[model samples]
Target: MNQSRKLCQLCGLPLTEDQSFLSLLGIMSTDSNNLCEDCCNQLVLINDIFCPNCGRLQATPEMCFDCIRWQNKGYPLLEHRAIYQYNDVMKTYMQQYKFNGDFLLKDLFNHDLIRLIDSIDKDIVVPIPVSHYTMQTRGFNQVSGMLNGQTLSDILSVTASKKDHQSQFGRRERMNRQQPFALSVSSQLVVGQRILLVDDVYTTGNTMYHAANLLYQAGAKTVKSISLAR
Candidate 1:
């Protein structure tokens, strides 16, 4: 095994002892070395109860208050799923991978994200786009980086340059923000298609709703969404 690969990607710890005997003997592949078991366990997976509409962690698997508010506002309900809770571990991971431009960190979630996408029913997958300024400064779109080499529909694009980051805004401010995305391709391509919108995080559910609304208006049959965290 490569010495470099033996170090955990997140915490930079030695992964030798973390591997099972079979893996060390070449009978099985290494397990969870991209993140050591300790680091991996710190992430809270959203496998238990979560909201059906927005995938927010909750006591029951029902539509959350935020989703209910969106519903009351007459926005189309988006069936969204997320892989993990936006806990401290996930927050640090996002800070490093996204804000700090640590592109290699994307590999930490690529395999799991790909598997999750494969299980979804969708005609095409569209990643949420970043603004031109973000692309220039960040060098890559965080959401797209997690997709690995999967086929993606590059149809949606940023409507205009954003002067402020979404993180700077509160939930109410985010929900009140104007639509920030538009279709890059013709409506014919989206017509009657089951589109899956992908993003790095689900905040107030505003970004996903805005994107889904555009797709719905473009004649999409359905618009579902998934995020790395909520």
Candidate 2:
């Protein structure tokens, strides 16, 4: 679609056109039109000064306290990157997309996610799986939809549970979550392969670590991660 005619994915404002000659080359892509100027400015992108391990926005490029603690507690540390800081704008977008089940909102970061996934050099990308209950209620796995056609290995599934949302739990409770994820019985495909885990958000890092632990035990050679927000 043409830029001026396209509605912003987040705010629904009409976008301005890119009059550059690249438009004629079919290279002036959706990135330039999906987010209007105002909504774009609201996004706080992660800078070089963020945590190297978890991508948490911080003053220095050191591993965040949580990641350090994870290693101390005998969990394998995941090298991570995030596209945006978890600010108020991201919180609102997450609520609208994940909680409210607005599946279309997944495109809000489509272009960026494609770029991020393209840069990652891994044998396979595995999106963190949601529980069956979440799939039935929310109608989709939020992380799975944001994966823009990368190499996917569906190696994990959430075990049946009666648990509440992760966001509703305290930090200690979140960290203490039981093994809610399990490898598919046929998931021997990741053996000795580099794996990259993708998820929508990194709150306490519990969920990703849980999946990574399972992947590592299942014989994955290495495990890294990327999330849309941190």
Candidate 3:
């Protein structure tokens, strides 16, 4: 019998244990598998209702007050959504990707992102960029790699930087990325196009707001944003 080779569910990249980037249990590194260990975690955490507006997991079967207020206020904050709450499970995996050099979680965590938004019609996928410091330390943009494209466009580019701002949350980790986010489409590339922005997380959304604002200034007519988890 000919066994079908396992390919990454997100990027369609072929996986082999011998040289796989990471390993999942019961999945031999020397054998073919669909995802590396980092990606496998995407499938494990489930069974919860996250607020559609803020994506916060709830304990009492009630809507998140923050999301409710956000909606009432006309969503000036953001059209935010996430698949999972930042529970211990989601938090551990995110830390692994952000600090430990596992870029694979982008696909694991955001597998449904583009699929859900494709119907809205976007010409480009702009990833939110990390500051020069974080980029130097992390070595890559997790946002850029998450939608690393099995089906999205082949071109992936980031074009601007905004001045970092103090964070509202008072959490240093949040402020570490305080640099203003920026995105530029060549005047020729986006005169009247609709675009969607992608990012790994959406906390205060200052980043998304700044990025969308830049894209809009560059001539985008409509902008929608998405993140893997908040």
Candidate 4:
């Protein structure tokens, strides 16, 4: 089958032109989405009862312990929303798309993500930037790639190249993480604007805080984040 005819990006399964709903409605839809039904069903989306601050799944809607600690430490209260849980399937997907540099794999989540981003009210959308080394090797920032060519603020930048990653650290180390980002442009643009920070995953959330802290200091009115996976 021709690749243009729409095979699932993850499993390479040949997709029908449209699901049976089209036949029932007698409406022809031509949009070719990436993931197959089986692959889509495997994703564990975050539930309504989750931490309001960090978007972690929970029995009730409340701030998680980590978010409480963040507030106690004088960090600004930044609300976050995550689309899916970082389960074994998500881990494998991240490894293949990000670490393994499978560029096209981003299409699997792009449409869903764009729809989610659209629902949020923000003056600017800023994706966490990748280091120079990472961009050279990975060929793209995973967060930016997930936005599917949408216009995003390029204000935040990774200042220095460190051979370290947040995933390499323990929880304690992540909590003590130092600032890794800097503003590339003047803060005048960010002042008094509601900002939405975007990233591929939310681990310890050290990265988001690092970025939000700077944005708040730069005069952002409100800061919120969205990650594809928690």
Candidate 5:
């Protein structure tokens, strides 16, 4: 499709004429499924000072209170990175892409995600898996959808069929929920490898920590995580 006819993936609006012109003439590069300038501007990238542990945006680069709490509980600090802030626009995008099952919306951030993953150093990239019930109903894992066909190690699986969605629980409930992940591969396979865990969002750091704990127990040398949003 021509640039002039291309529609913004998020808002479903046609690219502005000037944008098309610049893109067509090679003055500015653009993705095939681009977000219009307005919609793109609405996304708040976490480029400024942020919590080093959790990737949460903040005034300083120190660890946030949530990470401190996790440390106080004896959990090792996690080094995480996120692309965007979980703002109102991101919430809307996630609602449509995940809850509403708009599969094509995965392409909206495909290039960005691929770039982020490439920049991270790890021996294995393991996307956090959804419960079997979620896979049956949702037809896809949202984290895997955003990977854009990159290589991944399917080393983890859900521990059980969760009767309730994580979003349904409050902060305390989520933090207190039982571990939801188990390693699918042998401990020997994980030993001495640096594992990178990918997820759609990092809410309370509960899910990431749970997955990381299993990798560490199985003898992973290090565990790092990345998410599309914080």
Candidate 6:
């Protein structure tokens, strides 16, 4: 008689009292999954009070200020979501993801992503699109790479900007609040589908909004977002 062993979902190691619950959260995503319970619980966002769309911090259930502005003139995906807050750790991780090219972390990143997709009541998956310059310089789009070889990649595709839009992250982020994010969906892919855009972070949320609006304009039934952290 034998028993199967359990592994931590964050670092993917044999489970310990503190690390055993990482996989239980169902989004730790490491091959070995060695997350101690703290990260499993702490890293995950829960019971947040936010704008249903764009996942921005909202005072109440009603549309947040960003969404209101978008309605006047911005991307209008049916919904949007982000999983974490932008901070020092998140910044470091994202920088590492972009520059260092940590493809393996997709397991961790997309693990939460999968949870976001399944947990949040949404439709399709549209990972955020990076500009041409960033992609060329980085050698890859982290979002696209995350979805690659996964079930959702078939539905989502990258549509980069024409030139090197490599401006400051903050400035670019603010611009995305209402900036144009041109995306193309195939005929087969089109025709009234509910969509969920994915991204690494959710700061001003202009980028996700633009993307959502694009999908809505393209006849998507609904456009939503999934972020690892807000």
Predicted model with the maximum lDDT: 5
Query: 1-230, model 6: which lDDT tens digit per residue?
Result: 11135554434445564343445565454322444444444453534687876666556877787667767774444466676655555565576667777665555566556655777554456667666566777777787676644455334344545442424446645564344455454635645777767777776666666666566666778666777667
Q: TM-score of model 5 relative to the true fold?
A: 0.92
Q: Report the poorest 10 consecutive residues by lDDT, candidate 4.
A: 23-32
Candidate ranking under lDDT, highest first, comes to: 5, 1, 4, 2, 6, 3
**Which one wins by lDDT: 5 or 6?**
5
Off by over 4 Å in 3: 1-77, 104-106, 150-179
For candidate 4, the TM-score is 0.86
Q: In candidate 2, what are the lDDT values of residues 1-230, reduced to their tens digit?
A: 45467776676777666422343554543354466666667788786688888988898877878888998999878888899988887888888889988888887687777788788888888999988888888899898887766667788999847465675789999899887799885557878889999998988889999999988888899999999999
Per-residue alpha-carbon lDDT of model 3 for 60-168, expressed as tens digits?
5455765565456543344555544455555665677788887755556344665555644677656666666667778987776666553442122333333332433
**Local accuracy of candidate 1 as per-residue lDDT tens digits, 1-230:** 56445776667787666354434564322235566666667788788899999888899987898889999999888889998899988898899999889898887888768878999999999999998889998999999998888899989999755665676788688888888899999999999999999999998888899999999999999999999899
**All models: lDDT?**
0.84, 0.81, 0.55, 0.81, 0.85, 0.59
Q: After best superposition, candidate 3 residue 215: deviation in angstroms?
A: 2.1
Residue pairs clashing in model 5 are none
Candidate 5 Cα outliers beyond 4 Å, as residue runs: 21-33
Residue-level lDDT of model 4, residues 2-112, one tens digit each, is 534777666778765553334345332112255555665677878568899999988978698899998999988778998888987678788889988988787767766
Which window of 10 residues has the lowest lDDT sum in candidate 6? 1-10
Pairs of residues clashing in candidate 2: none
Q: Give the top-scoring candidate (TM-score).
A: 5
Model 3 local distance difference test score = 0.55
By lDDT, is 1 or 4 better?
A: 1
Q: Residue 146 of model 4: what lDDT? A: 79
TM-score of 6: 0.69
The lDDT of model 1 is: 0.84
